[model samples]
Each structure stands twice: as structure tokens, then as C-alpha cells.
Target: MKRNIVIASVAAAALLTGGTAVAVAGTQSSSTGAPTTHAADAAGTTAGESFSDAAHASGTTARASFSDAAHAALKAVPGTLDSLDLDHGARTTWDAEILGKDGKWHEVTLDASNAKVLNQHIDRDTDAEDAAEAKALRNADVSATEAARKAASSGTVTSVEFDGDRTPVWEVETVKNHKERDLNVNAQSGKVTQAPSDDDGDDD
Candidate 1:
């Protein structure tokens, strides 16, 4: 198990180095552990706005856009932003994080086009999941946001992940005109170069 940095106060919460949520603030508020929340897209927004600004706009989409979205999703979270990543996966989304909301950290993904939330997950710094995720983050040549933008040439990116085989690679999956394809991007080189995923779906 990977150890988290020592957390003494909320002020020190947002200093995540590797997906660590050193502290979460509330004892009374209950959160749905890793919930998949889907709501209608925010209406009447022009394109090319910064994700942080768009999330501050309004409604359900407001519940899941950028920093404010992460803020409202939970009762008490960190004040500082750890990492903000943008991607075209699942409709041009922003995957961002804030640290030490009590003993857990928050990650909220939002659609850039309409400012819709795709998913949200909270993790304690001590969770085993954080270890793997942190490793994946280390292996990436580009953010999921960039991979998704590149993926558009293939099709609409449905999802992305850092695949750890002998090396780190971004597994970008896409669907275009009702067809799907999986691509492997070199984490170090940021190239869309790798053989297709094996039949068993393993990178080996």
C-alpha cells in the first residue's frame, strides 16, 4: 500500500502529489461513494469558454462542471485545485481534482461542450485505488484531455485510461458512426502509435 503525506489541516489538503486525499472535512455529510451522476446538458452556452467559467454558470450542469461543480457536489471539500485535465473523451470532458475534503479527495468529470457532468468519484488518500491511479498518472505522456482531442480523428472518444504494460500508454477508445476502436498512445512520446488491444483486452 502506498502511504499518503501527513495531513494536519484543511489548508494543507489541496497539495496532492499523486491523487492523495489526505483529509476530508465532514462527519455529518454523507456522500454516495463514487456515484455515476447523469443530468441533462447545460443549455444556451457558446463554445470555446474556459471550463472553470462554464461550470460556474447554472443548474444540474452546474452540479458538475469545473471547480465550482466539484465544490457543490460535496458538503465540504478542499479550497485548492490539484490538477485540471481536459479531454474529448465522452464528449469533451474536464477531469479535475481537489484535495483533502475531510479524509477524501474529489474528482469530477464534466463535458466541455455543454458543461454536463459525466462522473464523480471520491477517494481517501489511503485507498489502494489511489496507488494505481497515481502510477497511471505518472505514465501519461499527455493528459486524457489531449488524447481525446487527438482521438477525434479516429472518432468520438468514449473513454481513456493509462495502461501499464512494459511501459505506460494512454488507452483511448473511440466510437465513430456506430463503430468502435481502441488506440494506444505512448505515454512518454505522446504518439498514437501502438498495436490494437489484444483479444483478451490486455496490453501484454
Candidate 2:
């Protein structure tokens, strides 16, 4: 079990790190977690446009393009625009199924700086059996937000998505009464979706 930082403040709830929220058994909360635009892409903008502006500016290109997007997002974050960095190697930006606080899957994406926010989408097509498995995981302390992809081998996460949308997450699973529990994680910089689990089969 690895231990990572968790930020729960609504003010700084951006997903800066890569995909999925990773955690160990007993973790603590902390500060600092982990942005956004377009003309800024063509001519660059000030630090007043919401973070989303920077994300959509570059669309889907290369890591360098994302770097440019990160710079743009930093410039538009509101204040004097401090420093910003983009890890083109983040997994959350590419994964498809991101967990959320509601113990459900959601679409997620985080900027290179992980300081801004974007909207969330859900996977309506996940097979009911798989959905049930995911729900079971959620019930076993698994975070609905992005969960750190435990490296199976030495493969890089190409692209990620939840059902179909993009989003961020912190924690996913927990342990209660000696049993793994399911839930959502928002330790540090990340996003968490809240979708009800009442949809039976009309999700498709």
C-alpha cells in the first residue's frame, strides 16, 4: 500500500497529478492538490479566463501541445499567474473509467499543472455485470475518483476515460471492519463525480 497526499478543499480541487488517486491503508489529509482556453492558444490570454479555457485550446495533440496548454492554463488561473508545469505523462487525462465520490465511474481529465477543473462524464455503456463489479469495488473502499493504476508491468497508460467522459478522482476504496470498503477519494488535487446508482438498464 502506497501513501499519497489528499486535498479536500473546494478552493484547490483541481487534478494536477496523473490519472487515478492512489492511497495506502492509513492516510491523512493535507493541502496542495493539483486548469484551462483558446485565443490564448492562438495569441495567449491573461490569468483571468477560467482554467477550462486552456484545456480546450490545444485539443488532442502531443505532450508538447499539452505543455503549451498547461502554460496557457497557468496564465489564465486568476492571480498573478505563478509557475506551472505539465506532465504529459499523466494517466488520468487518458483513462476512460475514473472513479468518483459517489462510488461510480465518471469521465475525467486533469491539466499538466493539475490546478484547474473540467466537467465530468459517465460511462453509460459499462455492462451491468461490470457496473455491478465496479459498484462492489466502490462499496469496498475503492474511490470513485481516479485510482492510481497499479502498474502491472512497465506499460504507460495510453489514454483513459470513464464510460466516455473525463474527470479526476482521489480515493476509491477503504477498509472497514477488516473488510475492504467502497467510496470516493478527494485527498488532493482531483475531481469527484456524484451520480446516483439507480439507473438499471436505460443508461445506454
Candidate 3:
């Protein structure tokens, strides 16, 4: 009977040791799985943040095209379009100058996003230069839109400004391959030509 008791005690101890080993293995597996889960979650969060940043950047860069802004300006003040410039301020805006039918120059500000008219006012400050520009615009058979189209072959037209020098022309700025190019479109003949560079050392 004593020998039988000893054998039973040995069997119980072995069972206990096996159970302890299984418990330790289970604890180790749980610990390993927890770190992997946390790592996966962290990776997902980082990817989400990166995607959000890219989306925000795209939203901020979105803007109304120059053509749309011009149309909005002309609608606000009916006249001959003179110049349109993209102005960067607290808000992106388009500063447009138009010669109104009332023989006055009107400055119109438009939102760059939706081409909404932000402000409009007559520019009372006129000079001989302004008068010359107006006369040139009146005589030009090629409209600003035409000038832009003619210069489109050069690149994307960014702005169009009137140049009332001896040879009246529409000074159009274009961007091609991320490089800025200046082209002169004859206001009367709709001819496109390269504009003189600032460092060309031409007095005229």
C-alpha cells in the first residue's frame, strides 16, 4: 500500500509540472501577441495621418482658374478687361483692372476659389499713362482672351497685362515645364512674339 501511494504522488507531481509548463507557454504567447497588435495599430494610425496630411495639402492648393476669375471680374463691372493678377494675401484673390464704359477704371477683387466678387470700386487716380493704356485697349482688335489663346502654345497663361509702349501689345506670362515665359501678343494683329527680357539692356 505504501508503494502504491508513492507512485500516485509521483504521477500527481508530473501532472502539476505539465500544467505549469502549459500555463507559462500560454502567458508567453499572449505577451507576444499584444506587442504585435500594438505595432499594427500604431502603423495604421501613422498611415492614416499621412493620408490626411496629403488630402489637406491638396485642398489648400485648389483654386479657381485665371479664366474663371477674369469672367467673374468682367461680370461684376462690364467693361474691357485690362489686366488680371493673382494676389496672395490672407486669402488668395485676383486683382483685376477693367476700363468701364463710364470712362473710368474699375478695380475688382475676386476670390480665387469660386471666382466670387469680393470687392469692386472705381479707381479715381488716373494719369496720362492710364489714358494711354485705355486708348490702346480700345484700339486693340484682339481681345484679352484671344491674346491668352494665342499665347497658349507657349505654355499655360498665368496673367495678361497691357503694354502700351510704342508697339501696343498684350504682355502674357506663361508657365511651361515649371519655367516662366513672357510673350507679347499684338493687340491689333493677334501676332505672338517673344517678350524682351528684363536684362536685355534695351532702353525702349
TM-score of each: 0.42, 0.26, 0.67
Question: Model 2, which residues run further than 4 Å from truth?
Answer: 1-96, 99-104, 141-204
Point to the candidate with the largest TM-score.
3
Instruction: Please write out the lDDT profile of model 1 over residues 73-168, one tens digit for every residue.
Output: 332333222343334332444454533334356666655444355676775434566555454444344543444445445643334454544576
lDDT of each: 0.39, 0.26, 0.54
Cα lDDT tens digits for candidate 2, 90-176:
332322233333334444334434324343355465565554444333332222112223210111112111121122233332211
Candidate 3: TM-score? 0.67
In candidate 1, stretches whose alpha carbon ends up further than 4 angstroms from where it belongs are 1-105, 109-113, 118-121, 125-129, 198-204
Model 3 regions lying over 4 Å from their true place = 1-62, 202-204
If ranked by TM-score, best first, what sequence of candidates would result? 3, 1, 2
lDDT of 3 by residue, 1-204 (tens): 000001111101101000001100000012222100000000001111222232232233325545566667766776677777655557656677777767788888887567789999988878887777777677666666667667756544556777776787878765443356788999778899998888888677
Instruction: Give the clashing residue pairs of candidate 3, or none.
Output: none
As a whole number from 0 to 100, the lDDT of residue 41 in candidate 1 is 20
Which model scores highest in lDDT? 3
